[model samples]
Each structure stands twice: as structure tokens, then as C-alpha cells.
Target: MSGTSEGQGPAGVAVPGSIRPSVTERHNFGRTASELRDYRAAFNAAQLAMAVVDHRGLVISANEALAALLGTRPTELRDRYAADLIDLASDARTWHAYREVLRGRRSRFRCTRRLKHPDGRALWAEVTVSPVPESGTVLLSVADISDRRELRARLRHLQMHDPVTRLPNRTLFFERLTAALESSPYDQGSTGRIGLCYLDLDGFKAVNDTLGHRVGDRLLAAVATRLAECADAGGPGHGGGHLVARLGGDEFAILVEDSTGTEQLADLARSVLAALQEPFDLAGQRLSVSASIGVVERAVSGTSATGLMQAADTTLYWAKEDGKSRWTLFDPERNAHRMTRQALSSMLRPAVERGEFTLEYQPLVGMADGVTRGVEALVRWNHPQFGTLTPNRFVAIAEEDGSIVQLGQWVLRTACRQARQWQLDHPDVPPLFVSVNVAVRQVWDSDLVADVAEILAETGLPAHLLQLELTESAVMGSAGRPLQALQALSDMGVHIAIDDFGTGYSNLAYLSRLPVSVLKLDGTFVRGFQDEAHANPADETIVQALVELAHRLGLTVTAECVETSGQASRLRRIGCDTGQGWLYSRAVGPDRIAEMLGAGPRPQAAAASG
Candidate 1:
């Protein structure tokens, strides 16, 4: 007690002359033997594990709590290195801090350390070491944080994994993908390339609709298990550390680390398909599912996690388009084209407002007399960036985006206006009917008869001279409101022609019930006329039968895509009432149509050879 200047180590060991002792400190240290007994009793009652260690990092003494926490007797803890109790490598920064304490540079140090208890339990300890400077001793305080750490680990697991499939969720997958991409080499070095296989199950929605979501969930779990197994197998070419993640719903992805090349990824894609070939037993129903995969591979540089995922999504759509249960690799050129299409889709509504759309006419010629009876109005988009784009490029997009009705109305009104203009321009000649193509969407969206009546009235064109051309399926499937609309349009003296006939499955019996007047033979039938007069006659025979059937049903037949003289001659011979195609000329503007009308019917040889 007399040698003590300030502070005490474990069990009141005095550090002599560490600091200048005040009179109050000396009086506090000068406790009787009974007071010292009270201090020892309080130390034994403490809950935190504590110890005193000498300058060499050796334990000098310990309390009962310290002994109990280590699962050892208090006497057995004495005379041991304090570093031995707090598990860490010798070269750790905390050890350097410990040296700083011993060198008198630091008064105290605190850090996290792992500890092994005598009973083989692992402990996470928050250890505080305070120096008793002059005595070359330190007081150590340890608190067990194992439960908190365990809870945090559980929470983190829940955050990063899917609840249904227990696979890495999108959040975690993105994190890992970003890390991999950042760490990988710019080129295909030994550090390895990165490959991602993004897959979506085909017909998964059908399973959800039929078997219920419970079955669908079980199916997803089974799929995830198989994918995880495949990834974990990591055989010769599969590489290592592949991450399997459930992106959501029926979609999943595999991140291949250290990927060698596309060949390796291709092998993995095949494995995935092969694995999913087996049936999944879900809710007492055996369900078979297939997947379409988009494979994208690149070196680490110039690619981000989001960009990789976007590329994967784009290629996955391509795989689905190419037919399901297949893999499509990322092609930059195709991706660029698809991006252009998407840009076009976004621009459609504005383009309609911008007046970028225009109509061209293709003459529907009377086959027998070689006279131009009507011109089919074909819509074209004069895109600002891209030149005139054909219907083949943008029609489907308009239909998909619900812009078809708007575009259809525009075409109808414009064609009707053009027809009125033509009649005004040529009152002395026969009225040339202008046919406008009507989309299936345009018919079902609203009252078609009202729209057509309005267009005819607005343009001052007679309904009889304005023919509405619908695809054959639309006519055959017309029902309820659509059927009534078609009947009303027919009653209003608007001619209804079924376009692209024989291309779709048409119920011939329903053709008589429809208010349709003209049927256009699909181009497939006319293309067969290329091989002499007799050789591949299947298409020609089909065309002849369709024409005869139409005639019996009192519907006039028009042949489309008659690009050659032989096709024109065969169509004319088959009794096709009208022929419209490039054989006469490609679709031209209204001025050209007026010129053709002004020229009147040409000679038969001129019609065929021209």
C-alpha cells in the first residue's frame, strides 16, 4: 500500500509511482485489512471477465468471473500469457497496439478478439487493456458478444437469400457481381473472365395458372436446388465459386467466376438444360419445365453489374424468340438493333404527333382485264433517324404498344381523303377504290363501323369506294361486338376484304357467315409459280383451290406478292379476281396511283412484262 502512487491492477496489485499520488489517493489506498477483504469479495462477485497481465503480456492474476468465462479455475489462469487467452495472430495490428501499450506510448488499448474457452466453446470478446504503467502490469476487461454476432449473421443471411428457394437473392447477386467484375482483369487473363447465364423458365406462368402458386413455389425450389448442385459441382471446365441466384419468380442466374471462355459457359448452359429436363414433383402433380438462357461473357473491364444484367435480359428474350429451352449468346450487333427497336417503340406516340407517318399505294389490279381497280394503302414511317420504314418493321410494335388503333385511324382517314381527292381529280374516269388495311386491334378497340362512317363522311368519299382489308383470322374470329361492327360496316356499303388468306387456319364454313367480300391469297401460294408451269405445283394447287372455294362462297379472290410474270399469269389463270404486288410496281405515292389510273388498263402483255 505504501509503494502505490495511483491505480490498481487485478486483485489490488499496486503499481508504484506510476503517477503523483494526492493526499486523497494515499488515504484511499491506506485501507485496513478488513476493507481489503471487502474489495476481494466485490471482485469475486463481478460478472465481467477481468485479469491483470505483466509487462511481458503474461497473466498475473484473475477474478472468479474471468476463470468461469474461460471454463477454468481461477488458480489455473495465473502465470499465463494474456495474448494466449485472447486468440489472434502474432502480427495483427492489435498486437502492435499491445506493443504500443508496453512501450508507454499508449495508456490503454481496446479491440475485438476471438477466444477459445476450455470447454471448446468459441467466444467473441470485446477486450479492453489498461496499463498500470510503473508496475509493468495491465488490467484486461472482456465482454462476450457471441449472441449479438450470431443474431447479426442470421439477419444478414435473411437479407441476402430468397425465402422460397434459399438461393442468393437479386440484392446479393448484384453485390457479388459488382465485386467480381471489379476484381477481374480487363482482358482474359489468368485472373479469369466473367460469365453470366440468365435463365427464365418457359411456361412457368401456365404452371402458376393451372397448379396454383404453391406448386409453382415448390417447382422453383427444386429448380434452385438442381442449379446450386450444378454450380457447386465445379468440375474440370465448370470453374469455381459459381454463384446461383434466384432473381425472382421463375428466373434465376449463375455467375461463373474465373471463366475461361464462351465454350465453358456454353457447357454450363447445356448442363443447366440437362438438369432441368427432369420432372418436378409438386403438390402431387408431376410438372416438367424448361428454361431459356441468355449467356453473356466478357473480361472484367468496361462492364458493370447493371450492364451485364441488361445484356443478359436482352439475350434471354432472343432465346425465347428463337424458341424456348435454348441458349442465345450475346451479340452486340443484334443488341444494337433491338435497342433501336425499343427506341422506335418509345418514339411511336410522339412520332404520330410529329406526323412522321405517311401512306403509299400498291395497285390491286383486275387480273382478267389488267386494269387497276383499287390501291391498297400501306402505311410507312418516315423516321427522322431512319429512312422510310416498312410495316414489317413497326406494325407489330404499334400493336404491342396499343398504338395500332391510332395509326389505323390515321391511315383510314388519310386513305379516304386521298380517294376523295382522286375522284375530284378524275371525275370523268371510273372511281378507283382505295383499300386501307385494318388491324385486329383497331376493330376490337371501339365501334369500327362508327369510325369508318366518320372517316368516309369527313373525307366526302363514298363507303363503296373505301375497302377495309382485314387479315383472314380477324374475319374468321370476329364475334360479338366485332362481328356486329363488321356487319354494320358491310351494311354501310363499306367493302370488307380478308387479307393474307390461307396463311391462318380459316374455318371455311365461317367464311360464308362473315360479311367479307374479297379474299387475298397469301404470297406463299404465289411464290410456287417460280418453278416452270408444272414442277412444284403444291402451292399453285393450293392457290387454285382457295380461289375456287372463294368463288363458290361468292367472295372475289385477290393474289398478293405477285412479283414475277409467271406468278401473274398463273394467278390470272387460276381465276384470281385481282392481283396486287411488286410485279406491277412497288408501293408508290398517291400521285403515281393517279398516274396509273389516268393511264387506264394496259395491254395484257404490258401488265405482265411491266
Candidate 2:
């Protein structure tokens, strides 16, 4: 038995030279078989999905992990093809490479592939297929990567957009602008230029002050979307590709590429203005907002992003300075002038602190008797460099910067002090009132009643002798608290006159209800009386009606700009209580006012002639 034994060979035929194995060899073979079985069992329990496929692409075996991944039992997957479980639409190239590995054409193949589960959901898998030529099988290992992909997508979204407005923020805006500028030069055969429009909302601060920041934020978001729509509408077919972006709070920008010339850019600017003219509906409240656009169009060759942005910023300031809610193109000359103004306005506060301002009084007279009844206080700035600047030159800047409140208080105190001095100089003359113009900010920011009372007390002037002139719109625009403040001052015996009456859409009913003592007809209305017969009868009728209504309400009526006696007589006949203009005398200093008061009332003919 130990000598020889027949062994089965190829094709199940017995071989004569085959020798039988000894007992030691048989025991060694059994031990080796047990080790192989243990290894296969451990491989079947792996956490990752593992599968063995034959060179023909048929799955020979699958582990529990692979069966769970495919939503099937190991027995069902054992004889199935690996391709049947994968999503074919994801990528056919990856599966082809896997097949090549199974065919022994490649040693290993690794890729990310998407698979369809039995539950009809997509699963992402990082798959590695390796060939085992001797075993005629391929080993496949897979790991899930779906969560990582979603996380990366979310991170990208946050980086490119604004948190508050959900629009492309400054970083993304610059990236897009850089790409646009780069492409613009190539498209134009090396001659094309890019145009940029920068916009800042006007009166946004007022809205934030009157409403809350919540409303302001919502308003900004709404504006961003509207601007985006405008950019979309101005695409290449109609105009060109335009990109809009939010450059932080209340500021937005647009990049218009491949512009032919400034005309096209200007048209784009106008379009933006027109688009923003529509009212914004926020939190159930209708709010009106306007934007000032600064446009710069230039060739892409020499301009840097910073330079373009700076030019746009400079132009935007010009738009704001030249009266907001308008557009201004880049002009070297205009920018220089604006720079000068900016310099002056920047120096104004220090100038004020250095005592650069003075007050000038213009006399308002009674048309019938030619006597000075009051004077309108006007501000004059004796700038060290730009000397003797009037209120027209700097008042707007002061108002915008919120320095008008301090300047207004100074004017009141100065005018009251001057009036007190004038009264001391002339005891026998008629009582004179000093009318100081009040700004809307002065009313809203300060305790106006207390300020007036303090000024009068400090100057030893009677409350009735100081008239506070407020614009008609300013008076009408007051809410519950501000209106109460005005009424409180009136109750304290201070006279309140509505200045520029015809300019605003004044409600006569509300006017009568307000504690106002006088209504000054606007100069525009009085100028109409220059040609009474030729002028619109409606003007005369309106003036007459205003006068009658004022009298009925026990308010005095003062007609402004009576340049002719005919006009004076017409106003007098129309029952205008008083008139002020060149028909009497121009504004004078305290000395002239004293001399005029001492001379007494001139004759009616002489007064009219003067």
C-alpha cells in the first residue's frame, strides 16, 4: 500500500506514474483546508462590502456586507452580475474598467461609483476592483461617500453667497468680475472695455431711523433681488452680460462687460435708476427708496480692479453731492470739483469750531406802512479760504452730516441776541420780531420747546418777539410726538409760521389744527402776481383762498417777493396781512434797522417807491 496508488488526473483519467499520499501528507492537507475556511469566514464578516466575481463578470461569492449594501441575501448575489447592482447612468467608463480588471487585463481598479439599492434610493460607493488571475476571480471592496459629497456642496454654497441677502457677496462679486474682465478683452479682439456701476441707496439711513433695522435688512434684500433682475434683463442679446452683486449694507454693484461705448453704459445706468424708482413693499408698509449710480467705462488694458472700484466710488459720491437719486458718469473735471467740495465739507466742522460762521438778517416789512416788522435770519460762513459762503453753499452739507442742529441753535441764539440789542436801541418804535428758520432735524433731534425757551431767557427777549419759521412740509410731516413738541412751543407764546406754504401739498384742515400763527406765501406764488391779468386765474384764486382761509383760522398771511407796487396793491386788496420784498427794503445790519426804526414809518408812496 505504501509503494504506489493510482491518482485521478486531467479529464478524470487514471495516471500510471501517480503515487498515493502517506498519512502525514493527508493530515497536513486537512489542516491547510481548515485554515482556508477560517480565512474565508473572516473575509465574509468585513464591515465594508466585499464581493468575488469571475473573469466572465459573474459574482461568484458575496459577503454579508455586500448583500446588505445591495439589499439582498448573500445567496441571491452569489450568482448575479456586479454590473446589475450598479447605477449604469452614473458612469459606464468606471464599470468598463472594472470589467477589464475581472478579465485579467488590469491588476487593480479604484473609482467612485453610484449604485441603486433595492429600496429605490441612490448610494455612493468608493469601489476598488482587483484581479486574481490564478483564482480566476476579482475582488471588489466598496465604501459609502454620499454624506461627504453633500457636506462639500453645502460649504460651497455658504462661501459664495451673502447670509443676510442670499445674493453673491463681495468675494464672489470680485471673482466674477475678474473673469468677466478677463474674457472681455479677448472677445473684443483686444479692444473691448468693461463698465462698472456702483449704487448706494439714498435716504436709507432715514428709513432705518424711522423704521427698525429689521425693516432695513428686509428692504436691502428686496433691493438686491430687484437689481439682480435688472442685470438679467440687460443680458447680451438686448445689451450685454451684466452681473449684479451686493457689496454689503445698502451698497450694490454691477459689472457690464463688452460695452461698445459710454452711451451703452449710460443707458444701463439709466435703466438701473428707472428700475429702482419703483416703490418697495416691506412688512406691509410701502416705502420709497432711490439709488445714486456711479458709472465708469474704460478699456480693460490699463485699469486695475481697485482703480475701477475707486472711480466708481468717487462718481457715486458725486451723484450724492449733486442731489441724490441720480446717476453721474465718470468725468475728470467733475470729479475734481467734487473733490474740492468734499475737502471743503470735510473742513467745515473744524471751521465752525474756529468761529468761521456769522448770521445776516433780512428785513420783512408791512406793505401798507413800510415799516420793518421782522427779519429773517440767514447763515453766512466766512470760510478762511472760500470766504463769505451763504447758507445755500453749506446748509445742505450740514444737514446731511447732522451738523445742522448745532448750527441752527447758534443761529437762534445769535438772532435773538441781536433782536434784543435792536429793541434796546429803539424804544419808541413798533415791536420787531426776529424770525429764525428752523430745520427739520432741529425739530426732531432736540427738545425744540426747551431750546427756544432757553434762547429767549438767555437773550432777555419776549417769546412773542421771536418767530420760528418751519417749512410747510416739515410741519405737516410731524407725527404724534413731534407735532406735540411744536404745539408745546406755541403754547409757550412763541410764534410759529409755516414757511414756503405753496410748495408742499398742505392740508388746510391739518394746518388749521396745528398751533401755527402765520402762513408765509411762497415766493413762487407771489412772483405770479407780477402779471395778474395775464397769469392763470387759478393762481390768484388760490392765493385769495389761502388768505381767506388763514384769516378765518385767525392766522396772519405774509406775501413774499412783492417786487412791484401793482403786485403789492393786488396782494393788499386780496387781504394779504403783510408783504416782504424789494418793494420796501433789502436785508440790512442792526445799524440800518435801528436808523429805519428811528426814522418812523415812511409815506405809502415813498415806501412803495423805495
Best by lDDT: 1
RMSD of each: 6.2, 12.9
What is candidate 2's lDDT per residue for 1-610, written digit by digit as tens? 3446576544344544456557896677667667877878887989989888888777888899988988879899877777766542256787677777877888888887777767888878888888765788888788888789779778977998888788888998899877766664666344478888899999899888989898999999888888877787776776535777888889999888776778877887888888789998887989888999998999887777888898999999889989999999999887777676787779777776787888767788776665667888888888877778877788878877878888888889999999998888876555689998998888778888889899899999999898989889889877777789888988988899999898997789887678999999998888788765656677789999999999999999998888898788888888997888887766666677777777864454355556
lDDT of 1 by residue, 1-610 (tens): 3454565643565645656658885666565545878967777778988987877777878999899888888889888888777763355797889877766689988888777877898888898888875777788889888999999999999999999999999999999988887773644444457899999999999988988898888899999999988887763444446899999988999998777789878988998999999888876788788999999998767888889989999999999999999999999999988888899999998898899999999888888887788888999999999999999999999988889888888889999999999899876567789988888888777567888888888999998998998888778888988888888989999999988888887788889889999998888778778848454777777777888898998989988888888878877887999898888879899998888766754454355556
Stretches of candidate 1 exceeding 4 Å from the true structure = 1-109, 114-123, 129-151, 158-166, 169-171, 186-191, 199-222, 235-240, 247-251, 280-294, 313-334, 531-535, 595-610
Q: Scored by CA lDDT, what does every candidate get?
A: 0.85, 0.82
List the candidates' TM-scores in order: 0.78, 0.56
Determine the C-alpha RMSD for candidate 1 after optimal superposition of all C-alphas.
6.2
Q: After superposition, how far is residue 514 of candidate 1 from its true place, in Å?
A: 2.6
TM-score of 2: 0.56
The RMSD (Cα, Å) of candidate 2 is 12.9
